[model samples]
Target: MQILINLDANHPTFPPGTLDTRSRSLMETYIKERFFDNLMYHEAVQKDFAVWLEAHQKNSQASPKGKRLEIRKIRSAAEKGLNTTTLLGEMERLHFDARNNVPDKQINFGLSHLIDTDFLARMAKQAGNPDIPITQRRGLMLFGATLMVGIRTSEWTTARLISDNPPVLPGETAAHPILVIQTAKTRKVDPEPRYLILEGFDRGALGMIEACIEMTASMTNGHLGQLVAGMRQAMLRVADSPEAFELIEHIDMRTARKVFTVESRRDKCSPEAVSAALGHTTTNNLRWYAQGDIHCERLTDIPLARATLNAVKKVRDPLADFNERKQLAGGKPLSGYPDLGTDNPNADLDNRGSASLANRLINPQGNR
Candidate 1:
C-alpha cells in the first residue's frame, strides 16, 4: 500500500523513527552488499588477483611475468560468463544461506517489472475507491505515476506535485486543463504546461485524499510554497505518517529522487518522453546512473477512460462508422450500354449488317 516502500509483516513493530532508520539502512545495504556484489561478478572472480598481488608485494622476486601468464589464462577462462556466474553462485553458496532471509517487502524495482499493467491498473482501482486509506492514497498516486509513466525518483521533490488541485490555466477547457509546471532540476527560464483531463476522473476518490493535503497547506498562507509543502506532506503521509506510516529515507533528497527515477523507467516510458513529461529538456542531461528511458508498447498502454466510453456508442449505431466507408459505390451506370463483344468498341459491323432486319421495325420497308 505504501508503494515502493512496503511494510514487512514479519519484521518487529519498531517505532516510526526506528522503522524509518532501518528502512534506509536496508535499502542502502542491500544495494551495496547484495546487488553490487552480485552485479560486478567478473570483478568478483578476479578478487583473488588482489590477494595474489599482495603476496607478490611481500616477495618482490616472485615471477611477476609468470604471474601475468597465469592471470592471462584465468582471464581467458573468465571470458566464459559461466565463470562469472560461478562467482555469483559462490557468493550465493557462501553468503546467501542464513542471510538468505530478507525483508518481506521488496524495494528495488527491476526494469522488466514495469510491464505489469495489472500492477498499475490495481493502483488506479485502489485509488478509484473513496474508502481507501489516506496513507495508501499518497503512496499510490505518485508511485503509480512513476510506475506507469517511467520517471526517476531523484526528480521527485517537495515542490513538484499538488495533491489537492491540479495547477489551473486561463481560458482552458473544462475537460482537460493544462497545468503549468517548472522543472525542479534544471530550473529552466520558462515554465511549461501539461494538459490533464479531469472529466470522468474519479474526483470522489481523489478529492478525499486532497482534503488532507489542503489541511496541511492551510498551515502556510503563501500559495506557491504552501502548494509544494502540501504535496510533500501528503507524500510523506503516503509513505505512511512518520507517526502512522513509518517514514524512511536518511540518505538525502537526492537519493529519494533516484528512487523516483528508477521506478519511473521501470514503468516502460521511453527516456525521451519521460524526460519531456517530467520537464527535462534533454536525455544527455540526466546522470548515467539514472533510468534513461523505455520503449512504449501501444496506444492501449495509456489511460483512456472517457474516450473508451465513446467507442461503445458505435456498437449500437449502424451508421456510427459511416465516416470511414465509401457511400457512392452504387451510382455507376451499367457501362454506357454494353455490347462489349468487339475488340474495337466503334467497329459498326452490327449496324452495317443488322440494319436490314431492324429496318422493318423502324420503317416497315416492304409493307408499311
Candidate 2:
C-alpha cells in the first residue's frame, strides 16, 4: 500500500490536514511569479519540475552560483512527498559536491581598487565641472563622501552635515567639520546617533559633503534616497561608457567600507581607531570590512612603511651614537690603546673608520 502526502496541510496559519482555498491560491500565485507557471505540488510533477529547472538554468543566463540558490529555494517550496526528506537530502549533497569541485574564488578588487588615484581624480573632476547636470554632480559628490566617510549606504541616505554659525569651509586647510549619521542598525533598547569628525588626513571628506549640500541647496527638502539614486544612475552611465571609469566595475557602498578600513590600516592607524571611525565600539565588528590583504605586493610608495622605516632609523642612530660616546668616555686612554687614535702607523685608518661610523650615525639618510 502507498501513502499520500498532503502538500497544503502543513500551512502554518491553517488547521492541520485542511487546505484553505485562499491560501492555496496565494501559494500558487507566488510559485508562478517566483519560479514558473503551472507548477503543481504533486509527486507526478516532480520529474517535470526537475526538467524545467534544467531548462531554466540554461535560458535564465544567470551565473552557476545564482542558479544553485534558485534551485535551493524551489526544492524547499516543492518538497512534499513520501520521499521528500530523502530527495531533499540528496539534492543538498549534490549541491555540496558540485561546489567542492569548483575552485575557491579570490577577491579581485579591494581597498586599492576603491581608492585608485585615477578613479578618484576623475570623480573629483566630474563633480567640479559646471557643465555637468546638477543632479549628476550632486551624485558624484555623494559617492565621494561615501568613499571618504565609510558610512553604510543606508546611513548615507539619512545623514546630515551641520556646522557652526559661519559654516565650515571645504578644503584640506578648512576648519573642523562634522557629519551626523542616524544609524539604522543598533540595539533596540538604546538607540543613538553617530558622528563622523572630518579633519586631518580625511579633510577631503568635508569638501565632498559641502559640494553635495551646495548643489542641492535650491530644493527646500531634498531626499538623500533620491540623491543617491541619481548618483547610482550616474555611476551606471560611467560603467556603460566605452571608456569606463577605472574602478567602476562593481563599486558600491560596501566597497567604500573596505576601502576605508584598509586605507586607514595602511596609514598606520590602529584597528581600534579604524573601528571607532566606522562607528563600531569594538574591532570584532570590523573584521568583515577589513579582510583585504595587509601586505600588498603592488609597487607603491606606502606612507606608513616609510614612516616606520624612518622611526626605526631614528632609534638605531641614537643608540649607536650613545654606544660610541660611552666607549670613548670610559675606555682606556688614547696612548694606552693601540686600536685608538694613538702614535701608531695604523692610527689614520682607525680615525677614518670612527669618523665614517659617526657620520653614518648622524646622517642616517647618508645625505651630505
Candidate 3:
C-alpha cells in the first residue's frame, strides 16, 4: 500500500502560522492576480533582477530612475508579505535599459550675453503704456518680473506677492518686498517654500507681478499658467527687435537663472548667500551658473599694470638712475648728415608756392 504524501499542501517555504484575515486576504488576492502555475519565489531571481536593473539603460521610455523607484515600492510591498514572489518577478521582467549618461540640459547665460537694463526698461515702459493691448501689457509686466527676479518661468508663474504687515507708505521705499515661490525645483533638499526678498532695482519687480496678477485675474480664472505663457511670448516679441536681437537671442528660463547667478556674484554677494537665495543646497551647483567670463570692461579702467609698477617702486630702488646718468653720459649725433633742413633752393621755392596757393584757395577775396 502506497501512502499519499501532500508535499505541495505542507510546503516548508510558506510562512509558518496563520496570518491575520486582512493579510491572508491581501496575499491570496495578490497571488491570484499575479502568479502563474509554474512560478515560485527564489533568492536567485531577486539577484538577477538587481543585476538586470544595474545593467539597464537609464534613459529608456520608462526612465531607469523611475523604474528603480517603482521597484523600491514593490520591494516594500513584498517585505509586508503581500504577493512577494509575484511582485519580485514582475520587477525583474521590467525593462530598465535606458541611457543614463545623458548630458544635463542646463545652458548657462552669463551677464555679457543677457539683455541689458536699457532694453528691459524699454520693454517695461512699452508694457506699462495704456495705448498697448491689455494682454500684451500683462505679458510685459510678467516679463519685467522675470527679469527682476531671475527665477524659473514656472516659479514666476506660480509665485505670489505678499505685502509686508504694514503696507509700505506712499513716497517711501520698502527695503525688502516678499515673493512667495510655491513650487521649487530643490524641494527634496530644501522642503520649505522659498520667500525671496526683493531689494534695489528688483523692488519694483514685485509690483509688476502684482499688477499683472490683478489685470489677468479674471481672464486667467486664477491660473497663472496662461498669463505666464503670454508673458513668454511677449518677451520673445521684444527680443525680436533689431536692437535687442544680438543681446537676447532667446528668452530661456535657465538663462534667466544663470544671469541672476552671475549678476549676484558681480554685485559682491557671497556664494553661500547666492546659493541660499536661489534655493540650492550646495555652492558646487552654483559653479555651473557662476563659471563664465566676467564683464571686465570696467576692470580695464583699473590701471593694474601702473598700480603694480608703483607698488614695486615703493618696495625697491630703480635699477638705474637714468636721470642722473643722462648728465654724465652725452652722445654725439651721426656725422653723415651736415644739414637737416631742405638744402635745395628750387624745393623751398616749390613749397612756398604750394603754401601760397593753399592760402589763396582759403581766402579768394584776400587773394584779389
Candidate 4:
C-alpha cells in the first residue's frame, strides 16, 4: 500500500495516506456500480467530480497535482490477491478510510484442489498395475480408503486391528467374512471368539494386513513410536511421492466399517443388526458411515436383513439397552417391544405372529 501510494500518477504506487473521505467514497462507489451499470462509472465519477470541483473552484485555487489517491492501491492489491469478488459484498457497509489503512490490510487465500471422480479412477488404474507388486499396491488402496474414512488423529494411539475369523480355510462353501476393527472403540465383539466369513481378496486387502503383522513381528522396532517411524520409511518406498501421508492414515479399518455400513443400509438391514455386525456400543458410530458417499453398486448383495437378525439373536440376552428378554427370548413381544401397526406404524406384525421378536427376519409388509 505504502509502495503504491508513493508512486507518481503514471507510476507503480499511490501516494501514502493522501486520500481523503470524498475521493475514497467515490472510488468505492465506482467499484460497486461499474459492472451493473456498465463500466461507464469511471467517466461518471469524473463527471461528478467536475461538477463538485466547479463549486470548489470558486472558493479555492488548488491544482489537480495535489489531488490524493486512495482506493486505487487497495483495490489493485486485492485484485492481485485473487479476492477479486470481495467488492461484490455489501458495499453499503464495507467502506474503508484510505488515510488510515494500508492496501495490503487483508490477506488472500488460494483456491483448494478438488477431488474429481476422473482423477480418482486414474489413480485407481495406476494402483492396479501388476508391476507395482501386491504388497505395495494394496497399501495404497488401504491408505486411499483410510483417508476417505476421516478418523480423528488423536485416537490413533491405542487403535488396534481386530479380526473375527476362524482363519478362512483353503476351501469352504460356507465361510463368513473377516471383520477388522479397533478394539478400544468396540468391546462388544468377543475377543476370544473366532467367527467370520472371509470376503473376496481382489485388492490384496487381506494380504497387506498379513504382511503388516509379519513385518511388525520380525522388526525389533515394535514399540508404537518406533513402529510408526518404520512404517513411514516403508511408505516412502511404496508411495515415492511427497503426497503420501502418515502410515496410520493408510490403515483400512475405518473404510472396511464404512463398506459394511453402506452394504447394510443398501440391503435395508435394521439399525439393530448393523449395530451388532459393527460391534458398536450404540447405533451412533453408523451416523458417520450413513453420511458418507457410498455407491450402491459397491454394496455386497448379502441378505443383510435376515443375516442381521441371525447375528443379533446370537448376542447375549439382557444387553445394556435391550430388555423384554422373555418376549424376545420366546420370540414374542413383551411390553417394550413394538408389535405391528397396533402401537407403532413401523412395528413388525409378521414377526409378532412368528416366533421371537428378536429373531424376526425383516417384515417386508411392515413399514421398515
The candidate that achieves the highest lDDT relative to the unseen native structure? 2
Model 3 residue 24 CA deviation (Å) reads 92
TM-score of 2: 0.41
TM agreement with the true structure for every prediction: 0.29, 0.41, 0.40, 0.35
lDDT per prediction?
Answer: 0.35, 0.51, 0.46, 0.38
Measured with C-alpha atoms, the lDDT of residue 273 in candidate 1 is 33
Residue 126 of model 3 has an lDDT of 70
Residues 133-214 of candidate 2: C-alpha lDDT, one tens digit per residue: 7777776676666556777666654667765532433322444556667666666566556655555433345556666555
Ranking, TM-score, top scorer first: 2, 3, 4, 1
RMSD of each: 26.4, 24.0, 31.0, 19.5
Which consecutive 10 residues in model 4 have the weakest lDDT in total? 105-114
Per-residue alpha-carbon lDDT of candidate 4 for residues 179-272, written as tens digits (9 for 90 to 100): 3333344455656322223344333444444444444343332343443433233344444334433322442334444545555554455555
Q: Give the TM-score of candidate 3.
A: 0.40
User: What alpha-carbon RMSD in Å does predicted model 4 have with respect to the real structure?
Assistant: 19.5
lDDT, candidate 3, 1-368, per-residue tens: 33343423546544667567788889888867775222324444444445455456343567556766766665556546534654443443332112122222222332334445665656666776777566666655655555456556556546667665634423335534556675467547646555555544343544566775555445544445555555555565556456455434444445545656556555545454555556564444655565332322221110000011111112211111221122223422121111223223233333444223222222211101
Task: Give RMSD (Å) of candidate 1 vs. truth.
Answer: 26.4
Task: Say which candidate scores most in TM-score.
Answer: 2
Q: Give per-residue lDDT, candidate 3, residue 314.
A: 21
Q: State which candidate, 1 or 2, has the greater TM-score.
A: 2
State how far residue 126 of model 3 sits from its true place (Å): 2.5
